[model samples]
Target: MSDTELRNDGRLEDEHQLDADDRLRPEFVDAVLDAVENGDTEEAHRLVEPLHPADIADLFELTPDERRAPLAAAVADLLDGDVFAEMNDYVREQLIDALDARQVADIASELDTDDAVAIIEDMDAEDQREVLRAMEPDDRAAIEEALSYPEESAGRLMQRELIAVPEHWTIGDTIDYLRGHEELTTDFWEVFVVDPAHKPVGTCALSWILRTPRSISMADVMQREQTLIPVDMDQEEVALRFQKYALISAAVVDGSGRLVGMITVDDVVHIIQEEAGEDALLLSGAGEGDINEPVVDSYKARVRWLIANLFTALLASFIISMFETTIERMVALATLMPIVAGVGGNAGTQTLAVTVRALATNQLTQSNTARAIGREIRVALLNGVTVAVVIGVGVSIVFGNPMLGGVIAAAMMTNILVAGLAGVLVPVTLDRFNADPAVASSVFVTMTTDSIGFLAFLGLATASGLVG
Candidate 1:
């Protein structure tokens, strides 16, 4: 979030409109809606104009979907590029669809290249072209170049506006350059020291430049050990690099090593949040589970997974059908089987969650794959032994049959062991094939646990002569 200057006029001070979390209060939202609904444009403007752009964006999100357009129209003047930058993607799309190309272009021009591309990248080709035609030449060129890069790549995420100077410049010369240039980017943490070809040679922190004497050369002050991101590098890896190095900013370089743009921590903050949330949503097969997403979109993302699960469920049924005679001979077996399946399913899910998280975070690598599997196996065995002993003694007392108890105890242990194996192996195997392990692993793991639980219990019972 931008350090949005507070509109802290006395009106909102008395209203106490924002909660402790900095979210706008429901009552305040209702008041804005009431004013907008009443066609009290002046009052609506007074209530909303004092909010920072991010808060304005939140107001739009908290409003009902149908009412959002009206709110956007009501506060049209206050809806700037910063507000759009902070909006939920679906909500921004909804509002963007309402405005003309010229208005959209006007907002895009107010932002840096990265922010502008983010707003324009989601538009239809025709609309994007129309908006591009309306923008100033320099802004249009920067955004067009950014759009040429792969989506969610370092090239697309970096801003063109940055401070760069030659390595030979002294502190005085650099400070003079900064002072004389009215158009220089205002928000930079460091100055990039570049060669004659505009390739970054080092980074000079703002603090270092200020503290150094006038005669100090930039090359003398700068740190050559800097992180350089390739233009085509994926955003997740970019975030990881930022986290690992604790970088405030990094220079993005083209394939030939020319500095193309700069990526700040602010830009990566959103990417980090987005990728983290995306992996989680993908794990549940809930595509981009944004609250503002349309009902139809939500349905389309969720149904395919449910359908996949339905087929897997059918396979489990087929396995149970194979043991029809055994269940018929022992009614108690039918009653006890679901416990085994449910517990095993829970165990598989636990392991799947851990394995997926480790894979996503790069905590699990090829070198440690054997160790991870070994660790899960050890955990599974300990869980199986404890659960088995409890179920074994309980069943013997409850049914007054030692043999039936032993059969189920043995089956429970085996199923849990299988569940643990499936949980870790399914995701790891998918990752090995370069498939997204989170998207399909849970379905496979759940199916394995359920099918194996039923098969193990019934097969053991029949083999032990506890059933016909």
Candidate 2:
């Protein structure tokens, strides 16, 4: 095969090969880099021509910002709506800034509502308004309405463009309308049947339209029962509904049950990814945690949590300070104190991780809250005994003081049990008060484990007269 005839997939070059998921192969990426270095724009375009828009987006993401301009210019027209839609937010914003408002609006018009909103939302308010003004009046209005909703809500996430027909329309009429209409959404799985007031009354799958007789009324063929999402609903809740129902797509309705938009599986797929990532980041006290974030912004986001942690650490120190007399009197207490606190802290962190995940996924609710707490308590007891026996015997042999060993063992058992309880209870309590469990729970758990560990070890030492 000629070099052009050798498809990236190792297939003989053909138009059909063009439709394949031709990712930017390592060689192609290398070729682009080499061409850019050599200032061979034609060679760069030739190398990029075979890749899909998503692949192009990936290239942009992988390339450094310095190389992006040359690479983007080399394949100028190829950066169409699909490629723009798939680009990372940071990259897309940068690229959009390079283009004028009209150019950005032109590209935005080709994308679906959710994708369009995503592209423009990151732009400055003035740029956003300019782009909106450049759009068709109807499209501009729909986007403006979406922009008005709180960010990350269902309204902002849904696509305003969708296929809907009056319930009274016959199957033939619906089919004809679909085939003839230029304004309908390019991709849809179900055609919503709406009432005179624009409320969604039913949904008819594409298969039903193709199979049913032309004369059948949509009302007769449409499934009357349908899942409708409220515009103001949380995106996470929308994802849960999609998961629960195994939905391909669902209608989005306003407060009065009027059909306003539609959310497809494509949108939900992004939501699931975003929500999962957000939860993981929040658990780590990282805010949004985007790599594109400025260093100062990142430091500012994390410092607040670190500051809160410093205070909690001080509280733990105060508990240890109260027992300074005990530590000074018995130097061995210093050697053994960390063992109690470290193990308890680790155990508490494990429980806290599980609890936060459960709460985020809605697996832990009021009905089973008590049962979960009881289960943790029992597990803690079992774990405490197992660990205490091993550590106690080891300490007894090493310190040559059975009393000291017994004291450490008792403290370990007490602290670990408290750890388990605190881990489960702290997050739940925070959630109950409408606070994010992931954000605030770690600080509380740290405080609990440290304070308890110190108190248990020191009090045991003082009461047993081990210090005296």
Candidate 3:
């Protein structure tokens, strides 16, 4: 095969491909680090030269903090727009901080409008202004317009470079225009056909344009049924629209319904990944939860949750204090009390995770809330009964007190049922009140399970005259 064909198929023999695990091997990373540390900049460049932009980003991430600058200097020429776009956010921020504002502007100018906004958005206001000043006027205007939108909105995510043709043009005219205009965006799946006022009326897939007769008018050949994303819509909502409508690309319109930009599937993929990770971190009260997150930031994010847990735990302790006399009288009650609380807490967490995820994905809506609740209640019943029987039988044999076992069993069932109810209700209630269910649900759920578990078990023992 010819060299061009070989490169296209990724079958070039000289290309350094990723390993089976798709990670840079330890030895390779070590050698490059050693080269940078030893002041062999040329050698370090040679080692990283064969890697792709993404792999080069990985190399920077893998290097020690002290070595990252030196390694970056070694591979400075290769750290282009693609490499910066592919770098981890924390790593990219570290590199951006190391560069001058003019240098940063140069890098931003090389990237697409959306990517340029992403890089600039994280800088402080003074640094942002400096960088924007250094950029070309047209690039600065596009970035400024994007930055005006709320963070995470479609306006921030959509690309400014898109093909929009007047609906009055025929296929032949459209084809000629596209062929002649070398300044048009190089990557677009569809052409948006707009009216005189720039309102998007229909969309024509590139494939459709290629197959249709050139004599046909753009208005007649274009598909009027199109998914239009609002400029102010959240990126998550934008992703959902793309998913629901099976859209490869959609026109983004302003409040007046004028076509402003386009959102393609590639942008949605990143939003989906970020949203998924954000929810998972929020559920655990671990802000960002990224390994690359700063130590001070991680501590600040986690300490407040830990403090909240401490207070809730004290509340559970107070309930146990009320039953201190009962626990002391029967050591068996003390031994088995933890089991009740532990099992109930596990059950509650399982339910909380499911409910939080469902709510985040819009799966648990008002129409299905009742059904979702009923389903969890039944699950709790089965789980409670099975656990109660196992613990009851074990206690009877070990403590030689079937009545005591029966008392503990009853407590287990009661606490588990309460846990199930608390788990679902806490998140749903928070969501209803405009709170993030994932961030606060676990705190409330754990408190409910612990306090109720202790109260039910001790209260049952006291009432049955099994203890005290």
Over 342-399, each residue of candidate 1 has an lDDT whose tens digit, in order, gives 9999999899999998888788999999999999999999999999989999999999
Best by lDDT: 1
Among residues 3 or more apart in sequence or in different chains, the pairs in candidate 2 whose N, CA or C atoms overlap within 3 Å are none
The clash count of every prediction, one per candidate, is: 0, 0, 0
Clashing pairs in 1: none
TM, every model: 0.94, 0.90, 0.94
1-468, model 2: which lDDT tens digit per residue? 113334546543334344333445555566677787788988777767767688889888877777788888888888889999888778888788888889898998888988888898888899998999899997798789999998888899999888989999999999999989897778899999999999999999999999999999999999998888999998988998999899999999999999999999988998899888887787778987987666788899899999998998899899889888889988988888888999999999989989988887788999999999999999899999999999999999998989888988999999999999999999999999999898878878888888899899999999998866
Evaluated against the true structure, the overall lDDT of model 1 is 0.90
Candidate closer to the true structure by TM-score (higher is better), 1 or 3:
1
Candidate 2 global TM-score: 0.90
Which model is ahead, 1 or 2, in terms of lDDT? 1
Q: List candidate 1 segments past 4 Å from native.
A: 1-23
Give the per-residue Cα lDDT of candidate 1 at 46: 79
Output the lDDT of residue 419, model 1. 85
Ranked by lDDT, top first: 1, 3, 2
